[model samples]
Target: MPQIILGPSQTKKIDGSVKKAGYAFLEKLAADDAVPGLHIEPINGSADPRVRTGRVNDFYRAVLFKVQGQGDEAHYVYLGILPHDDAIAFAKTARLKVNPVNGIAELVKASEPVAAQPAAEAAPEGGHGAGGAAPQPPVHETEPAAEAWSLLETRGVDKEALLDLGIDAALADRAMEATSDDSLIAAVEAAPQWQALALIDLAGGKPVEDVRADLGIDRVELSGDEETDEELLAALQHDAAKLQFAFIEDDEELRKAIEDDDFAAWRVFLHPEQRRYATGGYNGAFRLSGGAGTGKTVVLLHRARLLAKRDPGARILLTTFNKVLADSLRTDLRRLDSSVPIASRLGEPGIYIAGVDSAVHSVIQMAGSEVGAAITEVLGSRSPSIGGRTPASNWLDAAATVPDLPEELRSTTFFQAEYSMVVLPERITTRDEYLRVRRPGRGVALDRRKRQLVWQVVEAYRARASVEGSIDYGELAAVAAAYLEKAGCGVVDHVLVDEGQDLEPAKWQFLRALVPEGPDDLFIAEDSHQRIYGQRVVLGRYGIRIVGRARRLTLNYRTTAENLRYAMAVLAGGEYLDMEGEEEDSALYRSARSGPEPELVPTDSLGDGLSEVAGRVQRWLDDGVAPETIGLLVRDARRAQELVQGLEEHDVPVRVVDAHRDVRPGRPLVMTMHRAKGMEFSRVVLFDVSHDTVPAAYAVDKLTEGDRADALLRERSLLYVAASRARDELVVVWRGQPSELLP
Candidate 1:
């Protein structure tokens, strides 16, 4: 059978008609290579005769590399879709060959030189190799002297070492011309997988041997002249080569790829760092942390699929902070491979995906009447009917019963935090229990007398809640966890969590109770910089120990370098702690792509800011960017509605996205910054980030001075989350004074 291998060059900007036609071509080619409609033929001026262009339509053509195998099977590497002329031109210059140093397949430009050169003579006299000039720096910076020092040379990594690590001869010369880290990154972006990654590591001050060992490429050896087309075809099977090319096995896989016009091809291109964590085995709880766009969620999804594949009868539960993200995980899991079994519920021989709360609720529902008994065990009282009750309303009413309670302690924020962080996690039911429990992270201090008053308020609150058949989300999780613990915890064999940073202590306890403490039990992916929920949880206290099982990803594959810089700037050097109370290493994060610097537009008023947003979106539309690919994020739902109304006045079509309604087709998205988590867009506008509106007075108004810093950090994280959503372009609009969070 013929093989259809999809390359990473699949254009994200392809139009609907051309994408439809491209899918048809791939489907037909995968079914039978001899299909006449494909129109696969050699380019007339191609140096490598294997390069071919297939007809997607009359005007659009798909470029491919046809390699004949030893038997009847042939391998077709699909480059991308382009216009007829551009396809032919690109096909004529493209060469699919094996890297002589590392034995990995690489697609190179045939027009450029590929011969190896000595370290000292690679870039002679401030010039790159044959047919190439010295690379230039950024526009604002002046060119350095003829003897400008190279970062690689300073670190003892010469051109020969680069070539030995799989870099092409021409690329090694370009790399030797790099004087700064940014310039080195720019030069290596066009290199093959192993070569580019090795260069990136070296630029980051990693030793050459460390880079080789980390990438697992030290054992690979080859010679440039001994390689043949068959050998190059076999090289495509190497792990490094697969980072740029994915071989689609059958019609189903091809169909899945083409169904989503704006397909997520990045999921297929896993870096060595991510591939290891996703496929490797681990003991007990494992946590993967990274900044935005670092592919943490991608790793979690792949890990879930691997666990399912390894033990065919294993019951795996894949969950996140909310249903929308969980739904996304399910969809991506299917797209990752449609053959993976997806279970509708827990305790099944397949992957069960849901929100953490939803999973708890499912367990509660499954337990039925026994829920009351479990609730009784934790609350130290008879279980009342479980119903929705606003925690603020209950806390306020309960405070009224404790006249001697401190005015500061009466605040809803204090009570809510106290209940979630201390009471729920500890299952404190009596005044004695509340008095003995340690409030480690709380900003406020309370003596025995004050604790007694607080206990009175808690008692009153519970009595009222019991009478009204009301229970908060925290209590709900606590009950579910108790029920699971009493029932022996057979709901699932493994639990994989995404966005684990947002979960509170009760939810973590619930998650921990779902699986036994053993190998491959819990896999968590989170980023502290994206924690907008204001929950600073310590996972160790909740039975999820990850002291030595934690790892971090540093490279971002989604946002552009400029956008990532702007987003990280929004954090304003604020310290962000992970689930284990350790500071996150956010400074090491870098992006894989580069684009225009983020735009910050100041306006005189809210109306003017709205108009600016509308104009910018209109320009994006004129430039052929899809409406659904654009996002406008604000601080709250009210601001989102205001922006939607303002956009409508300007005749700009937009939709307000919430947990219930997702991004609509052919409409620009208007959503709160919190709702925009776990989502990405081609372009994003942080709409109306005014001085008074952000930091959102309500979030910090009633907080004590000691707690203000944490509240402010959460606000900064909100802006960071919004800024990182932009994959290509980012625009920040502020009316009057800008938010202090904006750097």
Candidate 2:
């Protein structure tokens, strides 16, 4: 027989006559000490050795082997041994145990019983001749097989555990098969107290009293229904009882009261300073700051309504970042108070709701006809002259020819017509002479040169209009701020500004000009997280004190935890820590329930990508997601055109919501993120969320131009706007490359 060592403590023996080549390999390994721990066991009798002829080839066989020290559980390793010579070399190189020949002997040796006692104890008591009375013939006493079977039977219990406690498996199986809950109870009746507790826990701890009643489980109590294992696990993991809100039973009434034209409800709800704005105190400027889901818009509307109620003749202004939201606010306000004459326009005497451009245009319009005409002319001249198209620069050149204009008038074409210019007199110049010639006087006279100079200066102002028109939203805010500061319009009794975080430093300066020098004159409400557009601007730079009165509405009733998790996953970049007690309820279902999980589809071509997204929209429509509830948000208008064409080809009704369109009831909206702020939908699909798109390549350099803090603030705010738009579901789909913002 050939012997082989398996491990440090095990060995196997095989008949040497099994094969000549196998015996030769074993002899070679034993000589080389490759088969360590090899030991031979003596055989009592010898017989003719039988030659093993057949060999089985199972080369891929790998075994998970375990080795244990005294009293310790085994540790496992996946050991692969091949029969080939190369495998023998590889095993040696890898320092693993190997037996090329008689490998079966090694395996058998490893499996053989370990020695339990010395050979001296192997003989029976009487065989050794020293044991007294030959153990009295071993006193044979046997219970009947039937009696033994009866002793093994159990009434009821955790059959497996009971069997582990020495009950027979057959008895335990029979006990488990018995009918009725009582059978289970009887089986567990003899179980240890700890075993009973384990069984109860496995059965969901039913018939057990809740221990946290004093802390109150009213908000998150389990319904009197059976729960699955997953649900129970979820309950155990979440502190559901901590997240509860005082139910507002009369939401309709509250919304109605907010919309009331009478301003009665607002008086009761608003603080004293807010009441001023709620009651037609629109002359002053203020800012509103608060977390998302709070009633910032509600206060804005109430202020508008109060203005309308206090003085029907006064013009109230309401502006936001997006036109759709402005229109929606208009609709909602109109629905609430039909008596208020609300006009969505600039320079309107009633209530005006618009975007930033509309508001600035209103101020420009008030500058009079000459200023307006010059602005038009300058814009036309400065515009590109491609194909001999009207060049906006021509208008600018014509206006620049004007001279001796006031500095303020020189900056804006709109300043040309209504107001005359007066140079501030120096020590050498007489103030009276300057006032006589340029100050607002009923019968002031001027020479032809001075009058012509004034006209030319007015034209110069028109030239500046083109420059102003080229400025972006942030620049416009800066320009507005400068204008307000130079004009010295003292603050009024009350000033209320909406979407405060979206305002830039310049815009804040302009707002400050509207606030009178008094305590509590300014009221600001904003969510820092919702500053989607104009993130380069900081609310604090606007110079408003954040008092302790700042309120945060943290509850999100609109989105489920799953939907929010997906949204945050796409936007958070591992930086956002979900606050305690902020988990969204997963049970809240959307009206349109069917849709594909938001996908990260890949396509080789842009056209294919567009087609894919368009197909998804069509499928959603077919699944009964109302066309109006579906939105295709792209990064820019150029990309939107392809999606629009695709939708049209599929005969799906779609509307591009830009500055021009009035948001209606049934049309689906397609727009850029810049256009979607302050508006929400039942479903939102943010497309082109790729790195090159979202923080669009152009916005990347903006951080270098603005304060780093302000830029980051604005970027986060923009993402907030995109996130809040989803009332039910938010799907962010991207293709080609993953967004840099993704984890």
Candidate 3:
């Protein structure tokens, strides 16, 4: 019988003589057939031979061999193992039992009889069965056989001695099992290969490859190039099924709601990407632009609510060109989230709500005395020739100086006479007396002459200031763009811009600067057709890309379909020809419910037209329409006043809503088309929709061909805006000739 090398430490200490002797013993045992029922065969040379040369410290000799018989095969057997002096010392230091000869002899003897057993009788036979069942054939008592093998074999080794060397009974049985049957060790060694196969199975499952692809991992091994469309579709369907709960289907209700211009439903059914645009990140900048009633403001409000909920510590700013619209948005936001603080730069808190001009003013305020001095110097530099004399007590005094003044300057006297003069229009006027009475210490007292001079200077300063800034509102965007260029975009996490399409090239530059390099940081909304101001803006030309994630809301809920149809017909050009009269029925836009059809009333003269429109306005008031809901929009302040007087003569509660005005407490808002850009009302009466009135004479004849077209486009956009302001009804009254936009 051969001795066994039990553990790695004892095997290392064996000397070469001991190892050779062990191997010789194993070979002789195989040749002699020492045990019955065992036909020993020496399959190979010693698997491991530990040889000690010279005086190498802590070294021993041992040999590993394979012993085979007719019944079973022993994968590993050891003989002549010896422990070194260091090995004995290491065991003693660790408080362990150390017996070199007995441990090795016991291991070898234990292995000998096990290798002598018949292959079939050593253990129970089991094969594949249906389901998880085990196939039964024959059974052998493995435990008793293992114990019998251990007891029968001896190489001057003791049982208690082997057990004391940390050789457990179970481990000894496993060793015997491995030595007896090569198949068990082969199965244990094949585990890693089985795990690899399991992974392949998982990867071959439906849609797993797609997920891997999305994650940028190779899925080629999982699915070879069979390219079966059925498999591909099944994979995608399986993936879609996983996200079924997250997706909001385009159902009949959603489709109908969108067609009916119900924003509430649209909000509910918004895609997750759309919701991300509305509320996701807040560290970057954003811009939302779109045609009228396309839910730009709706998205803005949603974004505000989302921001409020996400970052309660950070303040939110909401601004617009139209004061009324700004106020409306502020009101709506407040209604939606009461806990969120709301204020306007143009309104009270001087931070949240602001007009573009007002925001500029705040920046100027930060300029200290320099801005005030510049304003004073500019005001003083205005020519004394401009402005009005006190209301002449006599016609002789008026006639005396009136003739001496240039026609341009004389034509602007009414405007100059006002304390707060408007420089853009020659005829618009304001009262200095009223301003002085209302605001006592706002700034330097302005007589009619000084007011006129200051107005001129301020206009010039604004123009120069805009240019110097390289971007004012239009240039503010440019500055943003420049920053983006320099900073490389990672600085901002989110972006927001109100009136997105109104931004010109420079503004778009600013917008481009705001977009983060990553996909998660950018959100923008714009209405291409609603570029009412005709500003030289280009969103796409400046690298502001709109991918498939962009959404469009086409239905108009703010105005009746009849009006929307007419407006779309005029503005949409070829795209809307077939869509002219096609609109979902709604009570807000129906003529029967809201009012009469949007009228294209024309008269021979402006006075008659004004009177006729006034009569209709009075009739509307008489019919229970609130004065505030009825808006009278004209091309110019001169025409607006004429209509204002006409309505007043009919005892209508008329109030002119202008930026210059102190936002009158409550009156029928009488505004110019430009002033009414962002405002809305239940009923809007667009007064003087004549070709000449809309495309002011200067804009029509003075502009170059391209400029004229741009102006016309702008006028058309303004018309769209005005018509869309009517939530329920719309009326356009023209004198002499209809504008090209009128149906």
lDDT values for all models? 0.81, 0.41, 0.41
- When sorted by lDDT, best at the front, the candidate numbers are 1, 3, 2
- Model 2 residue runs over 4 Å out of place are 1-295, 306-316, 322-325, 341-493, 535-543, 569-608, 665-667, 701-720
Where is the poorest 10-residue window by lDDT in model 1? 127-136
Best by TM-score: 1
lDDT of 1 at 627: 91
Q: Which model, 1 or 2, shows the larger TM-score? A: 1
- The candidate maximizing lDDT is 1
The best-first sequence of candidates by TM-score reads 1, 3, 2
**263-367 per-residue lDDT for model 1 (tens digits):** 545556677678889998888899999999889988888888888888889999999998998988998888787888998887788999999888988888899
At residue 198, candidate 2 shows an lDDT of: 26
Put down candidate 3 lDDT per residue, 46-161, tens digits, no spaces: 21122111112224423333322232422222222344444333322221111111111111221111111122222222211000111112223355554544221222223222
TM-score attained by model 3: 0.45
